[model samples]
Target: MKKLFMPYRGAALQLKNHVVMAPMTRSRAIGNVPNELMAIYYKQRSGAGLIITEGTSPSPEGLGYPRIPGIFTDAQIEGWKGVTSSVHEGGSKIFLQLMHTGRIAHSSNLPEGHQVVGFSAVKAAGEIYTDNGMLEYSAPVALDEAGIARIIDDHVKAAENAIAAGFDGVELHGAHGYLLEQSLNPYVNNREDNYGGSIENRRRMAMEIVQKITASIGADKVGLRISPFLTSNDMPSYEEAAVHETYVQLAREVNRLGIAYLHISNNPGIPEKTHQDIREAFANTIIYCNGFTAETAEEKLQDGSADLVAFGRSFLANPDFMERIEKNSPLNELDYNTLYSPGEKGYTDYPELNYISSITS
Candidate 1:
């Protein structure tokens, strides 16, 4: 059997195949809670060995996007239970990705009485979509020491909630200029305190969150996603050397903690040396995601570069993604429209190959 289709055995993860469904926010969670529609959507695409859920806020303050789900509330947890149960019934493990959007948000998206907060007061230079339409990024309230502590606690509680909701584990959204990434970027984090300044100081928040979460839940049930050198979400470019060192150090620290996996959001901008350095530093399952076809993903697995490969758009468009790959069938093109719009038109309406074949016959 091909490596991509082969079962994987690693730290607390046993799966049907090596393919992973990368987390992509679909904004279908009406009222900031998961529902039956979301459960059906995940169950349809449960061919992957593991499914990391879309960015779910760990707290009310972290709901930075319109219609994104949260796991911090009782109703949210109950809603996610249906989704997790459906995925498990299809024989796939699922992890809830805890994301705090931080400064990459507008106030209108957040719940009443909850304001945008981040490592620093600096505002990201981009507009985020809200019910009121495109609005400038909200100026973040720089987290004092107490605020930082509370955020960390929120992440720990969310992880616990995920397990209660029937998730196999939890993945921390430490990338894409979210709250965790905000602290890692020196340009955004201008504090002189211990949580900012030098590389160690800047990375303190992430380390603290990871350490606490791993302690709260076993290390083997936790994963983190990172996108180094990604300038998205209005993240300013910093010294390249510093960027390389920051992640390498983080990899080493997490490795010491014996976490489940490190998900690297593949970017063309990252140097080969950076990849090699991260591969060497972190001695566990490393998932490489973004723009990988099945052929290229197999090549990555065979070359020993990535233990598992994650697909975002492929799974988004094709519910039976594994069946299509095995049969060498053409994939359905993704509809750019309704990517985040409410309802099931472009979301769950994508046809499976079997359904298409029956219709054509």
Candidate 2:
């Protein structure tokens, strides 16, 4: 077998290669429903061995940004069926990344003006761009035991919906200061209950969600995305000992559950020893994203530091990214203004290999 095209295991995945398409939040869905164009966008790049979708909300109240898609409603499910069907036809496997915005949400984007919910009432220090405009985030309702149970049920339903929509599996988005990450981070979760006292408890919410989701789907169909010390748009890095230790515990506990893979950060120089140490705790496939070059990814793969490398910005600009990597071709520069806009003008309008004339030519 070719070295770069080698197959690998992700706790359960029998995949074609180690190159993964990272989960990107493209604000293109309509009413949290995937459109035909969206399906085409994904199908265009099915050359990657694995494709993890954009962050999809598990519930309406959990929506954090305008036009971000979901996996909850009937329309959304049907819409995603189109996406999965198209991607599969293109000969690629994909995992639906189930995400919850938590306190990162804005009332304007929610249907009933629901207040954002978190591990505590602490409002993350950031702004959320909603349909109305940019809004200052408010303190989230501290999830009581009942609320925690409710959230778990929601995740279960979301996972079921994802599978029903024909996705290979569901990956809990536990990174970038989202809902699951909020419950794990001490800086956001300032509670005294069993859900927040120590590192183990703080990580309890994530574990419970995982347990519920796996129960709804099978263990082989369950995976999780986590950024050890990644700060969000509003949350600064509190990547201290308390935070790092919590994740080490998270990896230890979640690993036994037999998740597909543990998605992590790519900034080795920044996270340094702490990050590498955390990666050592989990004996599963580690997928790393953010600023990864082909050569660097190869080194990590050969060194056994990461089993898979997820490409972010590179994939956006180069739809033929996987082929380009294999053939070492030049990449196209992405147009920034069209990134978040509606329609194919910027999203799917980019040309393929022979379509666009090189700007430098």
Candidate 3:
């Protein structure tokens, strides 16, 4: 139980404790650029041992949601510099999560001349919120061989950009039915080439991206996030055996590469035995996230099931989350309405434990 508060070292980054702040999309970046407001929000939550930022696009075409941040342009790089510096000054390490929306994107959300592309021409089933209102997703252009090569190059460049922006590492968003996940889905990827036949073929693109990112920046500075059989974002559900086979193969490959860590988006609902299998297969640092409380996290740590635990909504609403756990203090309830809205109302407005007396009795 005491282990959750102890310092731990991974392949490249050192953390003060085991509580990671999971990556979540907060559509606060106006004009697709990071700003001082975003920096302030991250700085306020620096109590986290590590912060995996909201999904940030690796390129212009990767932009899916309105106002989501990007890491490609010079201005965007400069903007993230402010964020990384702020988080560092407060004594926390941060990793940028690179996400490509694939067929899940709305054309209006992207820049001029940019079109949505995916593993195949299938349209993801869902609506994305825009300035006007909810808009249906459009079918994407399927990538050819040259297109696949370009995507790999884009990922490598984004990884380098992340380092330049003062991020300690970069996480490839391989989950949530995004570009990488779409390729992994048998139902979505109907290609005949080397990239889309068997399980190994389907996993090719994801593996290639991981390899490229690792080559560009040492494996120690890269992490991959995967959510097996996640249904969100129009991702199809696979049989339990298929899910296990696909993820385990991925786990074994990444483990061989000796990447920094594997961040598993494990809801408590996932079978415990399956989680253990992947854990043993990787045999490296694992950060598990999904509705974990202080007690439950401590239990996982004590049982050696997880090396670190991630807090999402808890840390989102409580800037002093670690301190709150230490003191057993009550947490502020999150206002869901303001989560994706612009400005600081539901973001930096959450108070620290010490600030309560100044705000009220």
Candidate number of the best TM-score: 1
In model 3, the runs with Cα more than 4 Å from the true position are: none
Q: Rate residue 237 of model 3 by lDDT.
A: 81
Best by lDDT: 1
Model 2: per-residue Cα lDDT over 143-193, one tens digit each: 898988888888999999999999999889988888888888777778888
> Can you give the TM-score per candidate against the true fold?
0.99, 0.93, 0.97
Model 3 earns a TM-score of 0.97
Off by over 4 Å in 2: 9-11, 269-272, 357-361
lDDT of 3 by residue, 217-306 (tens): 899888899888577889888777887888889999999988888988885446666787888888678988887889998998888888
Model 2 has a clash total of 0
Could you tell me which 10 consecutive residues in candidate 3 have the lowest summed lDDT?
267-276
* Model 1 lDDT tens row, 252-297: 9999999999999999999999999999999989999999999999
* Candidate 1: worst-modelled 10 consecutive residues by lDDT: 124-133
Total clashing residue pairs per candidate?
A: 0, 0, 0
